[model samples]
Target: MPRHGRLHIPGGCYHVMGRGLERRRIFYADADKQDFLDRLGETLARNGSQCVAWSVMTNHYHLLIRVGDQPLAKLMAPLLGGYAGHYNRRHHRSGYVFQNRYKSILCDADAYLLELVRYIHLNPLRAAMVKNLTDLDRYPWTGHSALMGHRKQDWQSVSEVLGLFARGLGTARRRYREFVVQGLEERDSDELLGGGLVRSYGGWEGLKRLRKEHVYCIGDERILGDSDFVERALAQDTLKVEQATQRIQAGWDLDRLIRRVSQYCGIKEEQLTQKARGNDLSLAKALICLWGSQELKLSLREIAHRLSISQPAASQWVNRGRKFCRELGIEFEVIDS
Candidate 1:
């Protein structure tokens, strides 16, 4: 069966997982894990995303991220690709590093944020990589150490996670530790992993209960939430797709997009297509690249060719342009002639 497209909701939280190819070790040493974390930190900063919780196992890793305006792929592609490339070069080997595309589940933060955080942090302990909560507290491979005040990761959203527990930092840390300890006896659940009807309804028992009550609800493998939340998420995604389609149908071609972006950035249209770089010119090109790919559904190669830049450069511009547009409150609208 064909895979479904990822749900890209701005400001949404996700539980992301990636495994090494054939379940082999992705991080052969402490240095490898640190390298991956470094890339992750930089990626999160660049994309304005947050790492609420993360755990780096030998063969796999998990991240709970709250994305900014740009899509999760924007942050993930560079991080994963850069790390894979580094690993290959350092290990004197080549081929696919990861199993496949990383799995991400759009979570209902209000319902599952804290639970997910605890689940992620406890991974090391559950896997016997650490002896117990004490060992887990100081385990450098996960965000647990940072939250416990034993270590610091500037990229981890320490305060955000702590704040959910208490108004005061000290009290919050105490309560959060207590919460983590409470989860020690609980087995890993599919509900946390996320998927369609069974997982969404909290396993087969929950689904059977709903069935007996004659309650029918929506569920998607891409989302982790109640039926109402799932319905709303699907609706929002549908609306966005429809809007993009309408813009394309309304003749929002690359040339028109460039002209529009150039007009908005107060730069000449020719400047955007040139190799020169200036604040205004760069902004215009970035906007054009971003909108061309997103609104016009043009490929990065095409956008790069038109802007006199390489595909990689165009990808970077898309991210920069997304940040710029969000900061400037700019929206792409097709102006009728």
Candidate 2:
């Protein structure tokens, strides 16, 4: 099968899983788990991400992460590489540690965040690494202990997860534990693991219902969400690709992109290019920055120089521009190309 491209959306949540090669044990000792967590913490901090839930198992691991400024690839590269090197050197062995690539499923956070949290935290207990919920709470390798206040994990986003269950911290923790306890009866959740339409719609019956209702969804092994969410996510990606191709084929340059953006925003090129401070001017500049950097694949330094702004300022504009375009439902077309 062909490899699926990773769907990278900033501020997206992902359920990421990776396993050791040949399904061998990845964490041989307590120190190895700690080393992996430490590396994870550092990488997440550097990449500006938060771990909603996580657990280290004998042969594999699971992470629920809300993507930050950087792409998920940037976050995983250093993490897996550093940990593998550490593990190998410590064990006096040298070979491939992890399997091919990690499985990353772009998830609907609102739908699956709590479920994934419970599913991931209970991995240790389910794997016979712990006896019961009490033991799982203090298992030390899972985020469950941290959420229960039995362990301290400065890196984990405990407050946000607990905040979903209740208002008070104590009550929230109690309720969260009860919620997890209820799921103990759940058999292996193959749906949570990833299948195409079947998993996306919740099950085969749900998928059949959708077909019966004439509701078709864009499903992928890389995404888990509702039809609307999947469609929008894919549409956004398609827009990016089409825009890039159109701009490239039209032989667009910085000047042409700025002119087009200015016209679309009903502003003048001078007002957009010159140093101005207003919503309109900012919006125009942001659009220009996004087009120049993303579609044109121009460097931030180049865009900054063209706009007479600092590199940092141009970079900020690019981010804002993406949001602006998304909000405005803006799409670059080949009307005049």
Candidate 3:
């Protein structure tokens, strides 16, 4: 299988979303909704994550989560998949529950913070679940009420959004209430779902400025994370690959490899040349040395000189390792060397 790269984002702020398979109802009843919240609470406790915003729609959901030490996949894998299993078993259904893999976008918190909050809060309003902002305020299923102080949720991180709008809770709630209510009557300047980098910029000019400066983060649209964050994520990934290559390099020297194999595989170095290769440990040592040679780009002569064996013998060992590695999908040429 080909290597799958990690989705590199700029910063911690992310807008993650997913839908029910076939756009079916994700919440069939109040029990399903409450169970979802319970699972979310458990996930937050388990992963040590902060939930900035979220809303559970009938067929889809939205989230603005600050990723913790674990990758978002680690947390969601159990959360969503486990939930889907429960949902399916309960309803006598099978196969996928969510529409697809959750959509996650990295965001620039300073730039798109308020915009995201309003967008996330006003989902019910957009869907016409509420008649207007007045009804939205009284709606029980959305995060808008939580932000406005009309309702409360233990799992929601209200301070992040509240702090963005004002210094005090009372003032913040007042502003957020107004924002959500006002948004019901107005269309946002930018598309909340598309425009990727353009959304982060706030307008075409913002996107133009970033493009002019030549910034590209391995991030998706609908995400509002930071550029410096994107750079770091990509850089860390490069470092991991580089480190793996270094492991291969260190194991490339045939003489040293033979020594390591002799020590690790428990075959005396004297036996390496005698074709007395019945030892399992001895074979593994040879395999390691050969794999390292191919992965590290070591010359045949160099490998032969180090092993104190003919170039033909060294090449044979390397070939054996290459075939085995291809079959086993073992890329780390040196695990302990």
What lDDT does the true structure give each of the candidates?
0.80, 0.78, 0.64
Candidate 3's residue-wise lDDT over 110-197, tens digit each? 3355667778878887888778877777677777778777788888888767764556789877877776666667886554554344
Each model's TM-score, in the order given?
Answer: 0.65, 0.64, 0.59
Where model 2 places Cα greater than 4 Å from the true spot, the runs are: 1-4, 195-221, 240-337
Where is model 2 poorest over a 10-residue stretch in terms of lDDT? 195-204
In candidate 2, how many Å is residue 269 off? Answer: 48
Q: Give lDDT tens digits, candidate 1, residues 1-337.
A: 4545577788788999999999999999999999999999999999999999999999999999999898899999999999999999999999999988898888766556777999999999999998889989899999999999999999999998887666688988998999898888777777888643334464445765887899864444457764535544555565754445676788778877877777777888777667656788878877777767655557666788787775546766776877887787776653334
| Residue 212 error, candidate 2, Å | 13
User: Candidate 2's C-alpha lDDT?
Assistant: 0.78
Q: Which TM-score value belongs to model 1?
A: 0.65
Query: Candidate 1's error at 51, in angstroms?
Result: 0.6
Count of clashes, each model: 0, 0, 13
* TM-score, candidate number 3: 0.59
Most accurate candidate by lDDT: 1
